[model samples]
Target chain A: MTAGAGADAGVVVGVDIGGTKVLAGVVDAGGRVTSTARRTTPGRRVVASQVEDALVEAILESAGGRHLAGVGVAAAGFVDSAGERVMFAPHLPWQGEPLRDLLEDRLGCPVLLDNDANCAARAEAHHGAARGAASALMITMGTGIGGAVLLDGHVLRGANGMAGEFGHMQVVPGGRSCECGRSGCWEQYSSGNALVRDARALMADQPSVLTDMSDGHPDRVTGPMVTTAAEAGDLVARAAFASVGDWLGVGTANLVAALDPEVVVIGGVSAAGDRLLDPARTSLQRTLVGVGHRAVPRLVAAELGPEAGMVGAALLVGGDGTRTAAP
Target chain B: MTAGAGADAGVVVGVDIGGTKVLAGVVDAGGRVTSTARRTTPGRRVVASQVEDALVEAILESAGGRHLAGVGVAAAGFVDSAGERVMFAPHLPWQGEPLRDLLEDRLGCPVLLDNDANCAARAEAHHGAARGAASALMITMGTGIGGAVLLDGHVLRGANGMAGEFGHMQVVPGGRSCECGRSGCWEQYSSGNALVRDARALMADQPSVLTDMSDGHPDRVTGPMVTTAAEAGDLVARAAFASVGDWLGVGTANLVAALDPEVVVIGGVSAAGDRLLDPARTSLQRTLVGVGHRAVPRLVAAELGPEAGMVGAALLVGGDGTRTAAP
Candidate 1:
């Protein structure tokens, strides 16, 4: 393919280290992935170095000996506002780890690090669903909910670089107990885990195609299983989406009340598209206040596929991290 | 007293229009009020012109023949992003009313208009509790909750200027009903009304000092009466504060999770001081995530009293509006 913005900037590799896997990609300036590699994350149980080993393995394979510009790493963790260290990560063993500096020293090149949600938002802001919006909220629902705030063309990293931890925002008092030790978190009601929980609960009360799909074992049901069943017109799966989607709208309304963003983009499990967003829109309209006097921002699903994290990580490098360094 | 910052600039008057009162003040640049006047607010039932009449009376009274530099209006309503019109208010007559232009046409001087919560936040940011903080959240609780966000040096006004509407955020699903046509808003559990609700609920279970204080009528109880009772060491009153304060901390923990501000300033009912905030601080520490890992933003009461709205409004007209234009 002819070179675009990413290629013009030189060949750069981006890596997205998530809960279950590490995905690395060779990206061009145009936000397209030319080649990719993946590995099952060694995870937190292993030494922190082992996880880095898997990351390096994926990155080197994706580069394929191309002259490298720089590399960007987007990890599902609390990256400091200066993008210097990973303060903490629930799924990865990174606590106060200076991943960026360490990676730069090991690779002998530039390295950029940031929160995965922020990177995803930056990608949307630059090329995907949220382009041109002055203020936007990016909500990505995977095993849990992740969020990033964009204001005046920049991600609003808070005092501790933890500004967009939206999943923990309490939506229900004394409702569901969250792993965060807080009850009634928004994620407890609207995430991949919540979707599966709803599906399993639905099976207990009524008949479902999922019973056979999961071999009559509720524990066997996964998020992808429900999504596929719902796509094929299963009532139990569709109901679960409606339930989770409604909860998503409630939380979005709460956020809209606070931030009044110009747009909201739903990523992660967003391949479900209208099935998840249509009900959310209805609930958002019902829950939001001052509807007649104020503008209700558009809610849209992410345009990018699973590669959003990797592409967005690449965008963070921005023609190589040698210039426009992270602040 | 000699003038501080206010005298160095020209003479300015600020008006705060609330649900029940219209307070006007002649404020100097040093954030001090030299003279003041008050009038009962005509509220939303009256024609828009009548409310303006009350404002003009207070403005004239406070100015007391001093040459006016400018006038600022802090209304309990939604101010447009351009600061030109009052888009809507729960307790006032403004609905897309161009108060700024109308006042300028009549008085022939510059007029700046903004939301009362934003005005209060500006006061704290300029010279009160949040001074010198890199970022802060100002939450003022009276009949309900009012909030504003300060980032860097400027108040972070979002799209349509409706940012920081924190009171209406849903904290309970299918819980208390709010006047905003929503259920379980944060204000329902943590505002003046919530305190009274807790006090009245407590009164139902036992005989207490509130019975004599309110003349044996629960409806006769007022916020001030409860505060006085609590100050005098009434267990029931103290419990009510604890209840409301705990809810305040719960809601605050939610906000901190999302924004991670450097400071949180509590205004309005803050005259109770440690009586209210001590419980909130304890609960905030208990409920916040990553307790040992993240910095717990200081939770403090606002220093300015009832005059914060007026003082902040005056500051909006800094050194004359002809210089640093509002953008």
Candidate 2:
């Protein structure tokens, strides 16, 4: 493959450290991935160092002897404002760990750290659906909802680097209990987990294609399974999507009321294209405050898909392929 | 009275055009009010020119023959990003009017316009409770829950200069209907109207001191009357404060999750010291997401009280009293 601009100088590594897996890729200045590597994440039960080791292995495999300039780690957790530590990651084993320093020390290169959702938002703003939008709110509907706010083409990292934790915003008072130890969080009713939970609950009450897909076991139902069934025209699966999409719309309306973004980009694996978005648009229009008077934000699906996090993380490090100042 | 440093150069007239009244003051560089004036706001039923006339009267009366450099109008409405038009004000007569140019021409001076809540937030950030806060979420609990987000000592006006419309955020899924045509907005449950609504509903069921305060008419019950009765240890009135405070806390928690501000300042007329704040604090602590893990923002009462909007508006004009570009 022909090298892109700045590829001859040095390539930067971008790592998306999620709960289930670690995906790393060597990205050039133009956001092109030159090489990639992936591995299963060591579960939270293991020592934190084990997870760090996995990240190192993925980076090394992806680099493939390329001159490394810096590394950007997009983690699914609260990265401190200094971009030096992972304050906490519920699904990962990190609590006030100096991950940035550790990685920089081991990799022999400068390392930048950020929340995964923020990385995805940066990627979308720079190269995907939210490009050219003055302000955008990106919601990633994975195992739970993860959100990032972009204004003037930059991520709005609040007092702490913990801004854009939209999933935890209470949409339903005293509704479902969230793993974050909250009740009625937007994610509890609108995320991948929510879809699975709704589908499983419905399967228990009424027969659905999801039950057969999960081998007639309600407990075995998954988010993607429901999406697959919905794609095949399953009535119960479609209803589950409708329920989650409604909650998503409710939360989006709240964000719109507060942020007034020009657009909202729905990302993550469970977005399921039009199946989730169609209902979300209907509900958002119905529930938006000042519906007739105010400008409604355009809601669209994310273009970069799963690779957005890594691509964004790589871009966050300066154009020269070195660590940049915190956003 | 001795004139402040820049007072002799030229003073800026700051006008706070609220729903009930027009409060105008001549302010110096050090944020001191040299002279002040107030006029009853012509209700929304009147033509837009009548309201503009009231603002003019207030400014001219407050000028006190001082060498005026410019004027800043802080209105209880959505000012456009260009600081020109008032999009919509629930309690005012303005509707897509070119208020800034009209006022500038009429007064023969450069004029800046902004939302009252944004002005209050700026004042708080510069000279009040949120003075040293890195980021602050200021909630003004008056006729409704007007809010502004301050970052790095500057107001974060979103894409359309309508970022701080926090009152319209849906706190209740299918609760009370709001005038904005949305159901269960935060303001609908936690505003001055909500406080009075709760107190009046309680008055119908039980005897209270408010009956004597409001001449035994539930319709006549005001926010201050409820505060007075609650201070007098009336159970129903105190319960009303508790209910409103709880919703306030719930919304604050949601804001905390989304913005993670360093501080949250409760302002406006209905936030009567500890009466409303005590229960709000309790609810904020109880409902805050990631309660044990995350850093909880300091919640406090506004220091400047009602005059904040006027002072902040005057400051927005410029350091030298000329109208600066829109914030």
lDDT of each: 0.85, 0.85
Off by over 4 Å in 1: A1-10, A26-28, A64-67, A318-320, A323-327, B1-9, B64-67, B318-320, B323-327
lDDT of 2 by residue, A289-310 (tens): 7777767888999999888889
lDDT of 1 at B86: 93
Number of clashing pairs, model 1? 10
Q: Highest TM-score: which candidate?
A: 2
Chain B TM-scores per candidate, in order, are 0.93, 0.93
The alpha-carbon deviation from the true structure for residue A263 of candidate 1, after best TM-score superposition, in angstroms, is 1.0
DockQ of each: 0.71, 0.67
Tell me candidate 1's TM-score on chain B. 0.93
lDDT string, candidate 1, B61-173, tens digits: 99887667788889998999889999888888888999999998877778888888888888888889998888899999889998988886467777889988889998888
